[model samples]
Target: MFDELRKALKDWYKVHHRDLPWRHTNHPYAIWLSEIILQQTRVDQGLPYYNRFIERFPSINDLANASEQEVLNLWQGLGYYSRGRNLHATAKCIVDNYQGKFPSTYKELIQLKGIGPYTAAAIASFAYNLPHAVVDGNVYRVLSRYFGIELAINSSEGERLFKTLAQDLLDEAQPALHNQAIMEFGALQCKPVSPNCSLCPVVATCVALREDKIAQLPHKVKKIKTKQRFFVYHLVRNAKNQLAFTKRKPKDIWEGLFEFPLLEFKSEAEQITFLKDKVQVGAAYKHILTHQKITAYFIIDNFPAAADTEVIYLDLADLEYHPIPRLIDKFLNAHRHQIFSVGQ
Candidate 1:
């Protein structure tokens, strides 16, 4: 079964695998950066970031030596900032303990900060051609559907089941190519929505296709209810053309990144007038996250030069020095007129 899957997958991958930037290199540092950036990010969206990271760091030592703020700044628009933090921590570990060399074995790799089982497997196989299973979202989806498994992907049982299956299916002869081929097959062909079954090379042997249960085969745990959040952003600018921004602390969304002064309300029924007393109101917008819809109200305020002592000030000319969330970036763009108008 593994041999049949491998042959079909290898044939398909020869012509269909994406020419990703990370795929062009075997350097563990580069592979690690790509994997970190690609977490919770689409391949197309993650590519430029991957290039930027490689250009910025160039090596594990470079990344390890850089400040956390600098690392977060580079990872600004890419959400899930913990990945960046973990990447930085792992780089430091590699440089300090491993003498700037990424660990070759999956055991040593997993011991490094931020290198989880899947990431370790990816690095092990992709970098060292080590025989290890890479059980990512794509692989889970493909395997669950192909095997007609109904386990909820979020469950521990599902994790063990798929990990076993992935290992069983791995081709020891060319672990790197085989692992990449299966992952790529799932990403491009056995997609979550509207899969291109007609062009799928493995369709002939796909159990889901034979049973006519493509969509229903890979059962998922029901989504948890998302709580709504109301955020009032005080986009205060003073006479010096400086804007107010605050760095979010760790454990918060957009951690280590700057945004306008935020006042979070439990519900939308909170009075805007009450909010106005806290910060001068100027503009407002709503932004949604995977688990929350944040109704963000932007407030612009002008203050006397002496009164600007409280807010963190970014010189209008040097706003780029600070790393801000994309939502804040959008708000600044939308209210540029209001900010510029005040100083004029």
Candidate 2:
């Protein structure tokens, strides 16, 4: 049974696999970079970033030696900036501890910072051809619908069951090809929406097809409630024509990325009251994340001197070099008139 299923899937893959840049490489560093970038990111969007990153930092040592701001700048538009941070940190770890070589086995790969189970499995199989099943969203969808799994995927038991089933179906002789085939089959063929069930090779064996449970088979325990956040950014410029910026602390969405000095308020009234000095407020900007929705308002200010705080100020001409969030980039582009209207 396993051989039949594997043959069907691998045969489909051999003819239908997308010519992605990551798929052509057996280099562990390149594969690891691609996996990290693709998390919470689409392949179309992540592919260019992958190309740019590898081109700039071809080797792990190059990534480790580069500044965090350089990495974040390259990853500015990509929402999940933490991946960039971790990519750099892990590269440094490899260079410092592992002599710039990615861990060769599943156990060692999983032990590295920011390398989760899915990533570990992918690298292990693709780079080393180790017999570990990749259990990403694509795999979950494919296995759940084909196997008629009714357990909530968010639950531990469900995860265990699906992972076990995925492992059971893995073709150990061709783990790399098998892993790629399963993930691609799910992404292109058995998609979340209306899939091309007419061309499905395993439709006869797929329980969800016979029972019309494709949408319901991969059950989730709960729907996530995105947290709301309000941000007040003070875009300060001094007589020297330098704009101030600060680093986001850990545990935040844009952790280790640069942004203007920010203050959080529970409400608009509270934010207005907290403003010791009246400043020109720009239109509100909204930047949505997977688990958080950010409403950011910019306050434009000017002075003859600096605030004497820890804020690092850069010339307006040099703003392009510093890494800022997409929200800030949008705000700056929309209100460039205010910035250029004044001079030192």
Candidate 3:
């Protein structure tokens, strides 16, 4: 059954796979860049970023020599910024450690920082044609539905099961082609919701389709609990109206990105009374991340700039030059006048 499914998927993929740029080359650097950019991102959304990275850093040496800020500058609008940071770190590691050569096997690739089991398998199989199966969110959905496996996809046991199954079904004679086929099949045909079952190549062997359990087969036991945080950004400006900016500290969201001087409070009512009386207040802004819901308000302080030791002022013209988060960019775009307004 698995053999037939594999053949059907491969044949279907040969004719149906999207003409992605990264698929054109066996270059490991390009493959790694594409995989990293595609993490937590859809193909349509990640395609442009892949092109940008390739255009800017054509090779491992090029990426290794570039500054982190430059890489992040290119990755400005894309969310999950830590991937951009890791991409730079790994490039430098490859240059310094391996003399600009990417690892040829999954075991060696996995040893690199930020390269996990799934990513390592992808690089090895896709780039080097190693006999390793790459199982990610898409694979989890495809396997659970096709095999009628009623296990939580995020669980340790479930992960091991699906990985073993993916490897068993892989055609070792053509590992790269088979890996790409399965991944593309899951992405285009057996999607997470409302998949095109009528056009599915493996529909005859799909258990969930036959059993009418497509929606519930791929169960996830854990539910993410989002934290609600309230932030007060000090929109301070000197007499010259240069906006105050500061780089975020380590071990937090947007770690390396720049932001305004921030004061976190328990609630919206916990505003600083004296500061409120001194400066004009802006409207509250909401920013959402993977597991956080932030309710933020701007403190438009002008007369006296922030007295904080870490605060550094940026000219209103230079605000866009720094690698700030998308939320900050969004605020700046809407409140350009407020940021440029003359302070009394």
Candidate 4:
């Protein structure tokens, strides 16, 4: 069953796979860049970012030498800012420790900061043709549905089971092709929602389709608990036409990014009470993270408080030079006329 499934997937991939830039090269750096950029990001969205990064940085050494802010700026629209930071850090580490060459083996690749087991396996197989199975979300879904496995993917037992099954099904002689085929198959054909099962090469043998459990397979034991956060941003413009902005500190969201002076409230009531008297600058912005739902409001401070050392005043024109969260960007864009009118 595994052998036939493998052949069917590889055959399907040969005729139907999308022609992505990363697939054209076996260079570890390019492959690694694509994988990282595509994490939690769609192929269409991440493609431009991958191209921009490759064009701007060109090499691992070039990326290593670039500033963290520069990396973050390029990565502004793409959430999960930590991945940007880690990408920069890992580039530097590679240059300093590995002499700008990517570690060839999975063991060495996994030791890098941002490279997890899935990423390491992807790099190993896709770049070096090493026989390491890639077991990501796509793989888990495909495997669970194909084999009718009932184990929760997030559980340790399920992880081991899936990993072993994936490895067993892998075509050792053509690991790169097999890995790419299975992942692409999962992404394009056997999708999480409304899979193209009718056209799938292994549709005849798919257990999920046979048992009507396509949506129920690949079960997760844990559900993410989302936290509600409320923020009030003070858009204080001084007499010099400069707005007060501060860099976010570490161990928090948007760390190292710049934004207006912020005050966080524990509840919506507290946030509403504080903003009741103040005039809102723009429509309230709601930004959703993996584990947090943040609703933020921006208000103009006519008589601003004494400036703190951490707060830096920047001309409206200079705001582009600083990295800010998308929520702040949305506010600025929405109320550009009002902000500029006040400044003038």
**What's each prediction's clash count?**
0, 0, 0, 0
CA-only RMSD, every prediction: 16.9, 17.1, 16.3, 16.9
In model 2, where do residues sit more than 4 Å from their true spots? 223-344
What TM-score against the true fold does each predicted structure earn?
0.64, 0.65, 0.65, 0.65
Models ranked on lDDT: 4, 2, 3, 1
TM-score preference between candidates 1 and 4, better one: 4
lDDT of 3 by residue, 18-113 (tens): 999989998899999999998888889999999988998899999999999999999888898999999999999999999999989787899887
**Candidate 3 residue spans exceeding 4 A from truth:** 224-344
- Give the alpha carbon lDDT tens digit for every residue of 78-149 in model 4: 999999999999999999999999999999999998899999999999999999999988899999999999
Candidate 3 weakest lDDT stretch, 10 residues:
300-309
lDDT digits (tens) for residues 91-159 of candidate 2: 999999998878899999999888999999999999999999999888899888887889988899998
In the range 1-344, model 1's lDDT, one tens digit per residue, is: 66788898888899999998889989898998998888889999999999998898899899999999999999999998999899999898888888998888998988877778999999999999999989988898889888778888888988788899899999999999998998998898888888999987777788888998887857888877887788877667666767777778788689888877766777777836546454443555777888877778765544332333345878755667778888877876766776666432
**In candidate 4, which residue pairs get closer than 3 Å at backbone N, Cα or C atoms, i.e. clash?**
none
Best by lDDT: 4
Residue 129 in model 3: lDDT: 93
